[model samples]
Target: MLKVAIVGYGGIAKGPHTSAWKKIENAKVVAACDIRPERLDLAKSAFSSNIGLYEDYKEMIDKEKPDIVDICTPNYLHSPIAVYALEKGAHVICEKPDAISVEDALKMQAAKEASGKVLMTIRNNRYSAGSQYLKHLVTSGQAGEIYSGRCGWIRKRGIPGKGGWFTTKAQSGGGPLIDLGVHMIDLAIYLMGNPKAVSVTGNTYSKFADNTEKADSSHATFGQAKEDGIYDVEDLAMGFVKFDNGSCLQIEFSWASNIKRETRFVQLRGTKKGLEFRDGIIDVFDGGRNTKRARIKHNVDARKLDTGIAKVLNGHEANIRHFVDVITKGVEPVFTIEQGVDMIKILSGIYESAQTGKEVLL
Candidate 1:
């Protein structure tokens, strides 16, 4: 049994990770730490086995010496905490966005290399049956050569206003681009075989965030709202990425928008087959003498697979299992730090493109 220590006992810790850990046969949550005492208390109440709790995560690490450190912190703190965990001889599983900047992502990669420890970011979208099927189609030469793709996440006025950290540039990084778009980006890259992003052109907007009068009407949490403080982050962002393989991707993300539909979708076009998913249904259109449509069905618990926390924890478990198997049985992880670094670099390029009003060449 691998002893696990969870850092940051927030909504995610309570919701998904805690529940998922219960499902794992040989894994246990040995320790949990959070900056807030009440959060730590909540965790102890939930898993009352004399599970160690501490306000300082470092203290928990030093005392428990867990085999795995699961980081569910904000985007900006991912690097520091993950690096610290790896250095302390614990394999690390970090919640996505990995870090706020490319430089920090590289630093985390360096730490992982130096420690010779497993570091996996939670992008659970890749573990979904739909994603797995799609990957199989692409890799088995069924989808043929993928040319161009469009991937986006659209939400109608879904800004998490209650968390000031999310709106603050220093804490959560950019809004939906980093928070939600990262998942789509990861999926796109995974499907495209981690192609090098050659250039990016993007744009960001925060017009809706400037108006606070509609805060409650928008269903956003207001607990962390400051009456007159800065809310400097993008409410919507869009980007175009050109890959080294000559294929391109158009990406879109929005936290608050007036759009009619709130959905996450990816459309991929290839020489032999085309795939599109909308409203949880996967459709494949084949390019052959007799064109046909194939409807794909996935086996998944709808109740346990919807939320980001659930998806992330599910992916985390898969990653942890792979890491353990690789370490003990001499196998290899499906994904690597190099692929993660490339994703971050692409994200950074998109942000730079939006900032400079010009295409950022990789």
Candidate 2:
């Protein structure tokens, strides 16, 4: 069994990461570290009281000598924690929105290269039943050559941690763009053969920043909101990415908007047929006659879908299994560091576009 040490025993760690490890056969949560003792206590109680817990992550890593280190900290801490874990000679598995900036993401990638250890991010949607089903059709020529796509995650009223690190542009980077956008756009681009994004035109808005006063904060990842926290990030963001393959992707996402309702989906246009996967349902539209009419759908638990930009299986179960398999079974992780680099590039470009008021060239 591979020994694992998890950092940040908060909502994500306790909820999905730990739960997924429980279902895996070759991994064990031997140690966990967090800034708060109460959070560590929660992890101990949730996983096993016998498992070691510490307040300092480096101390835990030094003493436990885990084979794998999982980083579940805030947006700013991801790259730093991941680099330290990699330097400690452990395979690193970090959460989404890789890092605060492309520069840090590049540093993490460099550290992983020097460590000669496996570095994986949680894009578990790639292995989901619905995603896997569609990937089969696209790659097997059933869906044909995928050209362009439009995708988004819209919310009527949703702003995470109204005044915490999530709202601070310095800590959480940007609002829904960095948090929710990463989860949705990455999946769509991955299905498009991971094309090189050449440029991006983007915009961001913060119409609901005043909601911090209401303190009705309910974010899918961070949980309840902090009434008196900083609210400097945008509530909504939209962008169009141009790929080197001549393909384009238009994306829009919001934490709080005056939209009809909250929904997440990706509509891909291919030469042979079209695919739209929304709310765990994959719809294939093949023009007129002589088109394959097979529709692949699954009735997944709806409760989990409401949590951020998740997939049929989310990144929890499938990602944990893939991380373990990469170590034990010598299987390659579908989303590699190169892909992570690509994701960071596009995201950073989006932010630059928003800031400079000009289309950013990647």
Task: Report the number of the highest-lDDT candidate.
Answer: 2
Task: Give the per-residue lDDT of model 2 (tens digit) for 1-362.
Answer: 89989999888888889888887778889999999898998888878988989989889999999999998888899999899989999999998889888899999999999999999988866666667766766777877889999888887667765677778888887889888888889889988888989999899988887753332325543743566678888888999999999999999999887766788888899998898888777777878754333334434442243222223355578777777788887875677898888888888899889989999998
For candidate 1, list the clashing residue pairs, or say none: 162-221
lDDT tens readout by residue for model 1, 228-317: 555788888999999988999999988778888688888899898898755466778885555443343434343243322222225555
Q: Rate residue 183 of model 1 by lDDT.
A: 90
- RMSDs, each prediction? 4.2, 4.3
TM-score of each: 0.89, 0.92
Indicate the worst ten consecutive residues by lDDT in candidate 2. 302-311
> Where does candidate 1 have its weakest 10-residue lDDT segment?
304-313
lDDT per model vs. reference: 0.78, 0.82
TM-score of 1: 0.89
